[model samples]
Target chain A: MCQLLGMNANKPASLHFSLAGFMCRGGRTGEHSDGWGAAYFEGHACHLLVESRPSANSPLARWLHEQPLRSRNIIAHVRKATRGAVALENCHPFVRELWGRQWAFAHNGHLKDFDLPLRGRFTPVGSTDSEHAFCYLLEALFRRFGHTPPPTPALFEALAGLACEISGFGSFNFLLSNGDGLFAHCSTQLHTLQRRYPFARARRIDDGVTIDLGRHNHLDDRMVLAATAPLTEDEDWTALRPGELKYFRGGQDLPDGVPVAAPLLLAV
Target chain B: MCQLLGMNANKPASLHFSLAGFMCRGGRTGEHSDGWGAAYFEGHACHLLVESRPSANSPLARWLHEQPLRSRNIIAHVRKATRGAVALENCHPFVRELWGRQWAFAHNGHLKDFDLPLRGRFTPVGSTDSEHAFCYLLEALFRRFGHTPPPTPALFEALAGLACEISGFGSFNFLLSNGDGLFAHCSTQLHTLQRRYPFARARRIDDGVTIDLGRHNHLDDRMVLAATAPLTEDEDWTALRPGELKYFRGGQDLPDGVPVAAPLLLAV
Candidate 1:
């Protein structure tokens, strides 16, 4: 299994603190060391960096940690290479253009016997089940809402149905973002944490480093983070139940009040 | 107008020396100070870096100059913001996926009245005539070839016809690469140089920095470089004619021997 990390912020925020602890899972504290990738979204543009080297030792990853490249949405992955070769193309998080915006996806769990027929609308350059699933999800969205993206509630519902259907193959824990919103689905394991105005001090779970979140954040700052495992020891990290899908936008989870029907083509 | 630089090598060779001179044009030596981008292709994977900052003074561009990341195909651009805002999304060397391969394109000139109808296949994420032209080119290719990519000679012919058709709108000098080959189309200004055995010393035209190519390259190494202007002072750079299209694979230009007709949809 790979490890995934995602962040959504009301304002452009840096992932420096979270990445310090999360990247340790790539080699230092965990076994997910095959490859690593990170995508930072600034408006409709995404700055993506991926490497076949271990994140713990990669110079580029270290550079990323040092540079405070702020973004509204970010997704990262540390791969263990369960489904694909340990090459640069197979590194997550994978990026593609959809609906005139750059979309990024990263998977934490493996999928078994996933033989969904691709309609050539979105094709995977890598031979990973994760990429195949991402392509399928994007293709479904494109087919349903050709060119015009649906509203947030409808998109969330469509993604939820698609995630449920894909989870039937095997484990499908994944995080996806298209700059405007972040959607995380849990098939087996996923955790989420929200940071608001009244922030507190926290300690890194991987290392013993401690930090005061209040010092780095403003009064209006709000952010949501999702990872395969909790990165901080003191922060309140909520574990999502299996087969649950969570939607976050502007640094807060949307209240589960919007009603929408299942997707039209879940039978596929 | 912006500046474009591309390199196609028989081996994965570093662009350190060429970039040193090319980046100087971003701000220090020339007037293209809006933004800059570079795409380095390693196999089917592309490591893309773009910043809404001048390449001459940007920290990321400086780091790129310091690092010797080698690639068989590389494309770089320094933007002057002829038709778009100075944002990350509007930076040159725009990338998209086509035929299970990442395709990168960088344009140096501006287009006038380019209002082509998009087919919702490959949409431009940024508001730039260059990106619009790139999307149109890719959409045309996809419409012609469907899921399978055509042979090099056939692709070259298609691209040549498309280049000619697009140039009818305005100046359309560009560099395009899909890892396997580099295609250069010259509407007004473009130069090409090839370095092979018997390498000699060269001086940067921008900053007068000197380097002995023989010291860093093997005898069997070969590379073809395309730029808006000759990067080196002592190299025999040939100026391409207007409306000329050149294709380079494995560091050498494909001789004009493959007989192929113009694309059928050039009338469109």
Candidate 2:
């Protein structure tokens, strides 16, 4: 499978520092370098870039590190294909339009016997379980909500339910967004961390570089990072409880009617 | 990088049908076909499997369609190399031990200048940015909180701050878990969907097959699906806002102090 990385903040910020080290996983220190891509949200709109090449070698991924594309949310991916051909079309994170908004997604697993019928409203431009699932999700969203977007609470509720049904087919771990906030689900593995004031200098496990976020954002800025694993070497990343779910935004977890277990502490 | 697929629910469910359609994108219909892997969470543990081949052509992906791996949470991925040579050692959803919990992660983007040093507490066996990030994150968490766990609210706050700092380097979108509810982030692109009672039959966009989730889930059961895109033809899928982050557990968004913008309704 591939890897996932995300960030949600209370205010507009740049992921350049974190991304500097994170991108190295594509071809430098790691080996998932099939392709690389990323998105930057500015208000209600998003800017996206993708390359069907390794991040370490891809000039685009390199530029991304240097460019200070500011946004409150961001999604990026590096591929090691298992479901589709190694082409630009199959590279993630995949994007589409729904409820009049551009939605992006990326997957980290495979499902069999999953030849879904595309009803046309949302079609798969690429042939990958990740893309298929993305199109299917959009189709379902259009059919149910049409052009009118649902309230956040209600929409999150419905999405949670749908995620459960689809995950039943196989290991379904995913990251989703629409330039608003991120939604995540895990079947086998997933981890998360939030950063805010009183920030500390942290080191990258992929690279020995360290950064002090405290030097960047105001005390009010808060951010969240959910990944298949932790990204820093001096911060606390929590593991999701099995069969659990929650929602987050503006660097804070939203309150909902779901029951969640207390987080388990991992012994380092 | 690889793709990720995830499902969360209130009850045990199988991803046979949905995963089957998604697998097509791995090689037959999509381009991620370097390799495929998936894991189904059963209680606190997970059932894992992988194949260093196209999911569409891989017998393992096909067998998964017929084999009913039941779980409330699932994680899946299809590789499209960006780093190490195509091999199982480079495959994702990468798992590790933290605080006695198995943590997993999948990445979809690349990092730059990600050369980092480690304390050897957690070493990445694979040469992927995803793994390096994971090991770094775990090491950081252990360094910060040690064997004791912090409160969820505090933990989220710290993680979010760190994520933002790291994201500054490059695109970082990801899904993470420890056999529990999932944590996802969006640096550029990613989307999510939630489903619950009053569910109905839905079609897929890739293979044109349909499944009535209503037949599988109880009226009261809630499920969440997070992906690079939507999965159904008749539902609402929300996009993660740029620079946005979130957490999911149960069937609702967790309440946090951070500000969360409504779903983007920008014209397509």
Candidate 3:
């Protein structure tokens, strides 16, 4: 199994603080230490850093954990290599381009014999079940929508339906994003923390580090975090139910222009 | 226009030395300075760093310029936007995946009113004509050869032909690599320097920096570098003729197993 960490903030924010604790899970605290990867989106482009090395001891990972790179949306994964070899290509999160937008995906569970046929358009560069699934999803989405990008509600519906179908194979917990919005689905495990106004002090679950989130804000803007395991202990973390799919944008569960009674409500 | 620098080495080698001189063109020594980007391929995965800010002043670019990350194939570009807005997506060294391999391309020239229709699968995440041309090239290649990757010689023929057609539109000097081989096509301006045994001291053209290449060598392996402009003052830089398309792999002008009399000879 692998670990996933994501951040969606209203303003451009750094992930170094949380990344420090997340890197510990790669080898120091837990055992998802085969390889690690992270993608930082700056508008439409993504800065990808992937290495086939344990994060706890890798100098590159340490530099990233200490770097102050900020992004509106970020996704990271530390792999234990359930399927593919411990190579750089097999690291997550995997990226693909669809509808002129870069989409990224990372999974934490295995899909038993998930042999889905793929079109020549979107194929996997890495020999991993997760990459195969990501390509399949994008292939299906492109096939359904053709050239134009689908409306957000329509896209959410299509993705949720596809997630439900894939969940039948096995555990399919995953986090995905396309710069504008993030989509997370759970089959067995996934947890999230929503940080808004009147932020509270948070304590790390892996290490004994604590930080006060209230002192660094002046706006009502919020940030949402998703991870396969809880990174903090003091804050309230909400775990996604089995077969549940959620879409978040600009740190809001339902961002602007989406109806509250939209079809995405069916996901939860 | 943009400036491109690509390195194809037998062993994993660092680009920091060449990058130091190349980055100077982004803002200091010359004025390609709208934005800059570079992609380093480690195994089948590509580590891409792109930014809208000028490479000379951006902290991230400075860090990358100073880092010791090494790879067999590296492609870097410093862009002066000719067709697109100054944004992250508009930076050069665009990347796409084909035949289960990551392929990166960086252009140094412009195409006048060049817009080709995309087949949805490998659409451009950015609005630059360079990216549009990249998608078009990949779409055409996929259509020509369905699922399997074409051989190096066959791919060289197809790309040279396509490049000849695109060059008719405007200047189209570019560098492309698929982790296995590096291809550079000169529509107007491109130069290459091959470094082998008995290396001599090399002097930087941007800065009066000199380094003894012999001090770092023991084996007889070689590295071939291609760039838009000459990087060193003391070495002989061979300029590729207009309409020439050359290929290199493992630091060789012609890799093993290819008949020297193949159609690629037309490129010479």
Winner by DockQ: 3
Output the lDDT of residue A40, model 1.
94
User: Candidate 2's residue-wise lDDT over A1-268, tens digit each?
Assistant: 7787878777878887777776888878767788777766654435556666788876556545655567778888878877777766677877554543557787777777677676644445556787777777766766677657777777777777766767777766777887778777776677888888889788888888888889887888898887777778899888866444556677766655232456999999
lDDT values for all models? 0.91, 0.70, 0.85
How close is every model to the real structure, measured as TM-score?
0.95, 0.48, 0.94
| Clash-forming residue pairs, model 3 | none
Error of 2 at B95 (Å): 37
* Candidates sorted by DockQ, best first: 3, 1, 2
Lowest lDDT sum, 10 consecutive residues, model 1 chain B, at B255-264
List model 1's recovered fraction of native interface contacts, to 2 decimals: 0.58
Residue B186, candidate 1: C-alpha displacement in angstroms: 0.7
Q: By the lDDT metric, which is better: model 1 or model 2?
A: 1
The runs of at least 3 residues in candidate 2 whose Cα sits more than 4 Å from the true structure, single-residue gaps closed, are: A257-268, B1-268
Query: Cα RMSD (Å) between model 3 and the true structure?
Result: 4.7
TM-score of chain A considered alone, across all candidate predictions = 0.94, 0.91, 0.94
DockQ of each: 0.63, 0.01, 0.67
Please list all clashing residue pairs in model 1, or write none if there are none: none
Best by lDDT: 1
lDDT of 3 at A234: 90
